[model samples]
Structures are given as structure tokens and as C-alpha cells.
Target: MKCSAGRKVFKDFLKCEYSEENILFWLACEDLKRESNPEVVEEKARLIYEDFISILSPKEVSLDSRVREIINNKMVEPTSHTFDEAQLQIYTLMHRDSYPRFVNSQMYRKLAQLPVPNRKGSIA
Candidate 1:
């Protein structure tokens, strides 16, 4: 199965499970890490933390005490990689817990049969 197709199917599966915030948080961190402007990086980092890291947030992603403490300390001076550890943890969680289920899901089965596009933009 194509990685992109699998990711989309997995995200859909996550939504069905009401745990889409995990992927959303991970994607947001990816976007934030691509930022080149210091001010924008700081702003995005804070927003990501408030949206996904804060306990008060309804969209909070599950993070361990060590990663949480690291993020809390790094939040004082936010950087592009401020959420690296947390993001990795979430990624691992999805890869280990959700990915296998997604692979076996009917949605994934259907998606896997679809033709994928080639580099030339034609279906392969």
C-alpha cells in the first residue's frame, strides 16, 4: 500500500475512533517545525502546545510525564523542535497501536486496491 494512501486511511480511521487529535497534533507539529521565522515559530509552538499539550485542552494528546516536563521547560523559550519528544511519542503510539488496526480495517483494504499515481502523475 502506498504510504500516503495508508496515512489518509489511518487518519480516517482515527477520526472514526474519535482520536483524530493525535494525527492533527502530529501534523501541526510538522508544519510548525517547517517555519523559518523566529516570531512565527514561537507563536505556532505556543499554539500547538495550548492546543495539544495543555491538560485543559479538549484536544490534548497523551504524553508521558518526562516528555511533558521537557515540553513545559522548553515552552519558556519555544523553538521549532519544542515538541520533538512529544511528537515522537505520539507518532510511536499511532504507529504501534493504531497503524496495525488501520491496516486490517475495511477502509484500508479498499484503499489498498486503488491505483496509485506515478511520478509522472498517471495512475500506476
Candidate 2:
């Protein structure tokens, strides 16, 4: 999330918690991938949005540009673990939210795979 977008989102979330706008954002995000189920997706978004606040409440305005610049400039091996930690927060929240399905679209044995990533392991 960009700082401006985060500002708007947090302001809106504060106003209504889980308003239609928030649900719409969730729905739109869910529409983007070979995605997780609704409950899992909701949990994922909730976790990321929550993590965004720690930076926000600190009034870390400069972090927005720094985060944006780092995100824009990326190489797999050369990046710092701060980025890794933040990335893992996203992954952890997502993993904590999503799971491999118990059944398939065709009753096959396995429909999706959840690879255990080498992540920074977020506790929140």
C-alpha cells in the first residue's frame, strides 16, 4: 500500500472498521490471483492492513518514500532482511489465513499446493 492509499484506507477503516469499502477492497484483491478462499483472504488482508498501522501510527511519513523506492528497486539476493521481514509479515499473515483445500474442484486428491516458504516467520 502506498502512504496516500494507506492513509485513506486507515482513515476509512477507522471510520467504519469493516465497511463496504473495505469489503470491496478485499473482494478486488481476492479477484486478482489463483487465490485463497474468502475467509483466508479476509484474514490475509486484515493482517497486512494491521501491520501497516505500526508504521503509520509512528508518523513515519518518510518511510512511505523509502518503502516505495525499495519496492521499486528489487533484486532477490541483494536486498536487506528488513524487506524480508516485511515481506514475511505478508506471507505469514497469508499463510496463517490460507490453507490447502481438503477437497478438490473435481474430488482429486490435491487441488492446490502450499509450499512452506523460507520466510522470516512473523509472530503477529
Candidate 3:
């Protein structure tokens, strides 16, 4: 999640699991937090709701009824932090559930084999 390539690989794995929406929702929440413009925040929040909160969306993420209610209420006054609780729930779900599978995946095995860069900028 810290780097683009790593995120891409994880996203691919999530896609295979048919749960890519989890990461997508997390990324959207991250972007929303960085946004400063009120209009843009509102727009992004609406898009997030439509993409990951709405039951009708194909990319909807798994969320509990309590969290869903919180989100529904927050939509009335959207802010960058509006999805904070939902984001945390999804993040916890990914960390506790998907992360273990990800660590055991072939993709992660290949990634683990790659050489790391040393402080001198040479591969270690």
C-alpha cells in the first residue's frame, strides 16, 4: 500500500479473489483525505458512496449495517473524513483476512525473492 508496484500486485490478487473493491475503496479514502477543496471533497465522497457504499454497485465493499448507517448519515454533510469509520473497517478486514492469503500467494513469493536496494543504492 505504500508503493505503486506493490499496490498493483496486491490489487491483481484481490481481483482474482473478486474483492478488489476493498483496496479500491481504501485508495479512494486515502485520496479523499488528501483533498482540500470543499467541492472536490464532496464530489469524491459521492463517487466513493456510489462505488463502494451503494448495494447496487458491482464494486461494493463488505460493510456492516452499523457502519453503513454511519456512512448514510455522513453523506448528508460530506467531508474528507466522512468515510473514516468505514475506511477503518475495510482496512481491518483487508489486514486480518486478505493479508494472510496475500502473504502466502505466489505473487508475494515472487515479490519476496526480489533483491532489496541498499543504502548505497545498489541491490542487496
For candidate 3, write residues 21-75 as lDDT tens digits. 9999999999999999999999999999999999999999889999999999999
Q: Which candidate do you rate higher for lDDT, 1 or 3?
A: 3
- lDDT of all predictions, in order shown? 0.87, 0.35, 0.93
lDDT of 3 at 13: 93
| Tens-digit lDDT string for candidate 2 (1-124) | 3355533543444234222232233333334233446555445444433434234532211234555455334322222222333344434432343212212112222222333323464321
* Candidate 1, pairs of clashing residues: none
Model 1: runs farther than 4 Å from truth? 1-5, 114-124
- Best-matching candidate per TM-score: 3
TM-score, predicted candidate 1 vs. hidden true structure: 0.85
lDDT of 3 at 7: 91
Q: Mind giving the per-residue lDDT tens digits that candidate 1 earns over 1-124?
A: 1366556767889999889999999889889889989999999999998899999999999999999999999999999999999999999998899888777666765667755556797766
Question: Backbone clashes in each candidate structure, one number apiece?
Answer: 0, 0, 0
Whose TM-score is higher: candidate 2's or candidate 3's? 3
Distance from true location, Cα of 64 in model 3, Å: 0.6
Off by over 4 Å in 2: 1-82, 100-124
What is the Å distance of residue 66 in model 1 from its true position?
0.6
